[model samples]
Target chain A: MTTAGSPLVGSSGRGRVGRRRARNRERLVSAAAELMAEAGVEGVTVSAITERADLGAGTFYNYFQSRDGIVDAVVAGAVETLGQRLDALTQGMADAAEIYSSSLRHLMRTAVTDPLWGRLVVRLGIAHDQLIATLGPRARRDLLIGVDSGRFQVPDVDIATAITFGALLSAIHAHLGSDQASDPSGVFAESLLRMVGIPAEEATEITQRPLPPLPSLEEARVILGGDAEG
Target chain B: MTTAGSPLVGSSGRGRVGRRRARNRERLVSAAAELMAEAGVEGVTVSAITERADLGAGTFYNYFQSRDGIVDAVVAGAVETLGQRLDALTQGMADAAEIYSSSLRHLMRTAVTDPLWGRLVVRLGIAHDQLIATLGPRARRDLLIGVDSGRFQVPDVDIATAITFGALLSAIHAHLGSDQASDPSGVFAESLLRMVGIPAEEATEITQRPLPPLPSLEEARVILGGDAEG
Candidate 1:
């Protein structure tokens, strides 16, 4: 009989070891993220991550091809998480204020909780050509849906996506880097919503409370077509 | 008597020598910008800049304190130019769309024609904390005036400033880096205008024509507040 977790396990005693290997990879990524937050990107190294995760140097190599490979994995994981959260936040929102507020709050909470991820995004957005190129298309598609439904208004969906993402990342970077008065997340979200033209009174109310309901998936699809489906 | 050009012409026989020093400084900065664009930040060095500018090794030191200093000066000059242009674009505009269109067009032109400066800003925005700190306040004040005047309908001036600046810079970086498109400036400006809540049709029209006239100094003070006489 075949089993779901049998590929690595079927060969001798390798099955049990494969589960451990997967766990170890998760541990290493988590450890690397913690270190990056405390000491910035320069602080992460294979030796340090392995030590933090209580794994051997050999074990680290088994999971990742190189230090950069580990970083790439971590970054990819963070981006995926961010994308999922953003999708959830705007999924049903019909009102522009509600949509903007939910997105701002979601982004702020993510950035505050995982500042290293925020910093990594900002750094990559500016310095790494390949990564930004990959992320740009999906982001543009989302913005276009927002624009088409009147939940957002922009002259060009592509450019607005680039700017909004850039600004959001930069704000998080600044907030994390500073000791300024006020809640960083609140400040970051509030500012971004206003810049994109959500009314001040509406922005204040949304930021303070839970987001209102949005269009159903079908309704959104009717308005935004294939782009909204994504 | 000391005159405006006095610094350009040093006392005694040093006047001719001073001109030579100024010329060398200009050449070094220009060379550094070129090298940075061609090779990325890591590839630039004093030797490389000097060689590219056709100056001797000894000539480089006469002006810059170090390679970092050259980078600082080059960044400062570019930012100063950007600031001046923005100021000029906003000098007399009454409507938000006009201001947005004018400022964005100038910015787009700068990004396309002088891509090196755009890259420098992105790098500095990511790596240099102090530079961002200094520019943040001035940017906030400018944004606030627009908000108060109803030229912009943002909820939070501070957040709006961050988003506006961040979006512009990010879009420019993407445009310069991409090989898939042509003339991204119009699209970029239109995106920004739309984000600020301007109607799409109006944004497109303004972006295609000359920007609205900038406010005179007197009018600017009235709108911005503070010393009307100053």
Candidate 2:
């Protein structure tokens, strides 16, 4: 589906080139994700990415114009389906508090169980453009819902959103740094719910409520209609 | 007094030499502080520091063994007086909530009014060892008081401390990034106070209360018995 002769589209003009281009892009994105998860955004290099993918250095340029292009692709590829999954999980939930709590809980839980996702996020910190682009508006949307429903007493939704984003990154960084055994997703969400004006007891209850299973990546992609070829 | 013939202590062996060494060390620390406050922790280098201090490159090694040494000195020199000043400001306050709010307010207010201090802190973030070493304990100490006095209902002091540290940095980053005219320190502290179980009304009241002046660095030094030369 990419334009002809685009570096990311590869130089091969054969009938199967489109399929090959897509697969190559996927490989490049995953390689960048792994490196980001391991050493952070600043640690990534085009050479390192190509090396990790076991592709020729020149093959990298055939697929990406720069390191930033690959980084964006990695974030978009990872977050698009997950964002859809979160929306699906929170659908039809009337309680805005529960909706917010559920979304945050899922993120925290995934960070714990999914090393690649966790490290990528931790390395990115709170200032990565792609992360904010993908999740910032989603968080604000849920927070606004709570405010509109009178379920939360936030002073300013924008400030609250910033706090929530920072708090999540910090909490995850702390959780991963320590040897603490218990899953902190519940506690982390509880703390933020309270910050947004939910009472302690209610916030605790909402966070501890059984979380539904996250849709698998393949399922999420299908649900999101992300398979361009099929 | 530093041991004789130490690289960190300088090789000069005379009465005036010790005084000169102390003066040069102070100069280097301030130079580093200025650079860090301008360009962040990562931006300062030994060459830049010496250049800013107007000292020879080799002179930097006379007092500091490495760049890390100067960085620590800068943080210590800056934070020590500020920490003591905060202690003086909050002394004899009976209400733990007020004490906590006051401390946080002072920190936030400083960040807004003092551009140098603000930039330095925003650059440091939460994980900088020097920052955590200075502000981390003070925050925890005040938080523990609130918890002990039944004024706060924190689930975990350590986690709360981590959250507060991260939230402050993030909030400041957000605030500075925007052109909002109003000071956010009060609202920021109020939100945290509420998170720790203070009722919204009470948190607002506590945060909005009159803030006392921070003791000057000199006065704080006197209070701390920090006159090493004497």
Candidate 3:
């Protein structure tokens, strides 16, 4: 307890102690993500995580209380920033259909371009508790927007949310499994739009629309409350 | 190393040794099913299975090569009979859409009525390798039927199959999580039918059509190659 001088509770954001704490925490999360990507959610252990992070044994306990705690952090670190990015991208979009389509397309595009992201998503799969916790509300929120706008004929938001989630993960699984050339973002979202009662032509048009570029992960870290980038 | 007089491979189907072998295998499968339903796929260990079956430890290896071998047996034992029953029910049905709808409705109804089945399906989820192995091809076959009949507007059969699998498991998870009164089978199938390009009104009507009684599990066991009912 003599660490009253520790940077964990430093008054200055730029202080040495504050910087060290953030760096250590980031290292732990990155190591956790790497391990999860390689071996899946169930395969990870705290000792493995600390070892991979190059931290001393028991160092993980200072950052995360348990394996589940770090898992939540890993998922939150991935999904929350993406959620924020999507929100910013669609900040002023009036059309709910476009908003929904844009978010899905971007998600698929990210998975396509980022092998690590794709592996993490495919490994976690659809029934992952942390993934669902992080992504479910965002999906439901988007569905409700489409419903409220008179643009969708959804029978039930909850069921639609479930279907959307399942579709995204399963589509990702199939997309990654295949060597065929096709835009998963367009095809996957178009199918979903139609399911929610969007007309065929419109669904196709919306999903195929050009997507805005996603912010770099380093920038997203800042947006997610991490310290400034190098 | 079997006892000299034991009939592990007796020629006569009606012989005492043949009967004992079938009985023992059936007991092991039933015990495995109980453990899986009570816990989950990951929770079932060889020792736990043997303990549950009340058989000597080595008897498990006599029946199943390993835990995975038995897990496959458990999923195949559950899914294959259901697949066979659906085939029989839809054999003469010309309407591809109706055939697809009927199969989904029966699945959901089984989950609703059979809590054990529901728990197992929800626990296994869509990422389950064995569940997908057993159900994936069947799902693709039905989607192909609808596509060939010009009754379904499927963009990609593979993606559609993935969605169907995902939606079914996630919906089941939601259904079991909630205490709602609405018909899950009807709503879930209707939504999927629309996703595959069925008209909303038609999809609703098809999903709401009177569902025929599913063959009982005992009957299913017989259809799946277990012995006749007592």
> Chain A of model 3, TM-score against the native?
0.84
- Ten-residue stretch with the least lDDT total in model 3 chain B: B1-10
Chain A: TM-score in each model:
0.69, 0.85, 0.84
Which pairs of residues have clashing backbones in candidate 2? Answer: A7-A62
* Alpha-carbon local distance difference test for all models: 0.61, 0.75, 0.75
Backbone clashes counted, model 1? 12
Would you estimate the TM-scores of all the predictions?
0.71, 0.84, 0.86
Tell me the spans in candidate 3 whose CA falls farther than 4 Å from its real position.
A1-12, A215-230, B1-20, B215-230
Q: Could you give the fnat of all candidates in order?
A: 0.54, 0.38, 0.64
Give the per-residue lDDT of model 3 (tens digit) for B110-153.
77777667777666666677788767888899999999989898
Candidate order (TM-score) = 3, 2, 1
Tens-place lDDT per residue, model 3, A1-93, is 111111123235577766887778878888888888787877899999999989998899988889998877777667655766676676568
Tens digits of lDDT, candidate 1, B53-134:
8998878888887998887666555554354446655755676566656776766666666676666666555435544654
Give the per-residue lDDT digits (tens) of candidate 2, residues B24-49. Answer: 88778878878987776767899999
Grade the docking of candidate 1.
acceptable
